[model samples]
Target: MGSRRQFIKTVSASGAGLVAASAMGVMQEASAHPTSVWGGDIYSGPHEMVKNSKILSIKNPDGTETLGVVTPKGVIDVRAVAKKMKISAPLTLDQLLQEGNAAGFNKVVASADKSGVPYLDESKITYGRLFKNPGKIICVGLNYRQHADEVGMARPAVPPLFNKYNNSLAAHNCVLEIPPPEISYKLDYETELLIVVGKRMRNVPEAEALNYVAGYCTSNDFSSRDLQLELPSGQWMIGKTLDQYAPIGPYFVTSDLVGDPNNLKIQTWVNGEMRQNSNTSDFIHNTQHMLSYISKYWALEPGDIVFTGTPQGVILGMPKDKQVWLKKGDKVVSYVEKLGELKFTLG
Candidate 1:
């Protein structure tokens, strides 16, 4: 498979329309959707992708992942249930959203629930990366008021934007291997709200931004402070996008269920101690503003994700004398209201 950079280069070299048509053809062949259109268009207005659902990505023994839906009974393996019932369904969450197969997926979920199908216990199943290959992983820096105050940096007139590569993507409960100490050891945990875009957005208005969101998930923006801030000019991307540095998931709760994304409570814990306790209400630039602002510059597409920004209480916020950076064997847990807890260990 081609790298995201290479894919972008190809999309740039060739017009977006042509590339999109080709991709749509591939998706049509694999899923139930015949056209690329999933949600409403800009003229028709935005709409949420999934509703009242908690989605999961289950890792298979053969190194593949399948889509699962959380039901009162248990977690329904979409692929297994679809196969047994001879129903057409998207095999993975990525395919479901990216290929405009939400209708098919919803059908599978509804049918599975009423068909007396056997479902697997979520606790016993191995989790996979909720998002495997998002087109973009945009991040907002210093959007939280307390975090900016703690870092002693003036709040920007506009939201600061940075990015991470797909390689940094990790699953909940996965182990992250820290880089060698010679590389730098000032590792920190950043608990933040994550937004998953469900529809295409370009110059979207603040009032309608939430309509384009598919759902929200618990995510940690793990950072290597030395590489991010101590470098010559500061290497924000390099420090933020390391192997398995961005661990998200446990569950992807739909937008309707989450209600107001900007009013949610978010927190982080190191071992058993709470290190950060704040709410998205402290955002200098809330979810609406961030999405509307970003849409002004770049078109946000389906399956793309954005990290809203972490709050105060990071190690960098503490005075130099009291600073004790995170080390190997440390366990970090991130939580956002309505979104499940995301836990990982340093190896």
Candidate 2:
């Protein structure tokens, strides 16, 4: 696949008349339209390729949302462009993932005359969760080599796995309604890279595991340390799986755009202070190994997300007296090399 800039050039050089005429012929043979499109809902189409582009969702005033494709000019509303051009397009990211309708979306984008369609200034739009209601929200624990050493623990022989529910998912720029102070006050931030599975697979070998990835994005495994550590059995889930705790996004760049998930630089900040800064290079179990290992027992499906572990510098790794938890009104930002910053506010 080509770079994003190169992809845009290809789209611009090809006249809309030619692209639209070709797209119209393709849409004519496609299946019937659904009664209506649902926000964050799944679609039946298989995963298909558009261009080497990033995907995201925007919140509409009516409580519904629509899908948009990131272009050099700005964010092109896929639904809007499809409507004006009269083409078949997936209305949600999950739909695109499940249906594999990238070709349809690509046609819509190609058919758009550069100046004919209206693109939204990214800041003006309220971002929605990169994905909603995925089949599984799998996570890794203590998988970063440096993080393990900092927290005073030896590297594990195998990956520690955990799970989070749908309620934990939040969008970039969204405000997290933190749990009540009485529930547990040790709120913490964990900056990690997220992996989105593109297809259904099982018993996949490490040699070709990355081929199954849909894309990569930035994420925060927002945690309540009190619930996690104070409990008798080390309630990792209770501590880690609170509502809005798994805030992700800003953009979901396709695997083609992010060639090396294991080499990106990852960092986190609280308010204006740098909190955690490290690279995925320190990951003990790299992306390919994590996916391959997890797939041994579970059939990874489209939209299934894996929260690859966070690096060192988390408050949990700080000296006992130096640790300070996140509070209401705090702004948390997480960034990965190609995946844009995932920002959110507490309270």
Q: Which candidate number would show the highest lDDT if scored against the true structure?
A: 1
Model 2 gets an lDDT of 0.86
Clashes of 1: 0
Per-prediction TM-score to the true structure, in the order listed? 0.86, 0.86
- lDDT, candidate 2, 1-347, per-residue tens: 46998988877878776888888877774534334255333345656644488988898787766688788888898877888887777777777776677777788878766527888888789998877878899999999998999989989887899999998989989899998889989988999999988888799999899889989889999989989989898999999988889998988888999998999999998988998889999999999999999999989998889999999999989998998888989999999999989999999
lDDT of 1 by residue, 23-104 (tens): 9888887566333332222112123376788998999999988888988889999878777776666777666666656666
Clashing pairs in 1: none
After superposition, candidate 1 runs with Cα above 4 Å error:
1-48, 113-116
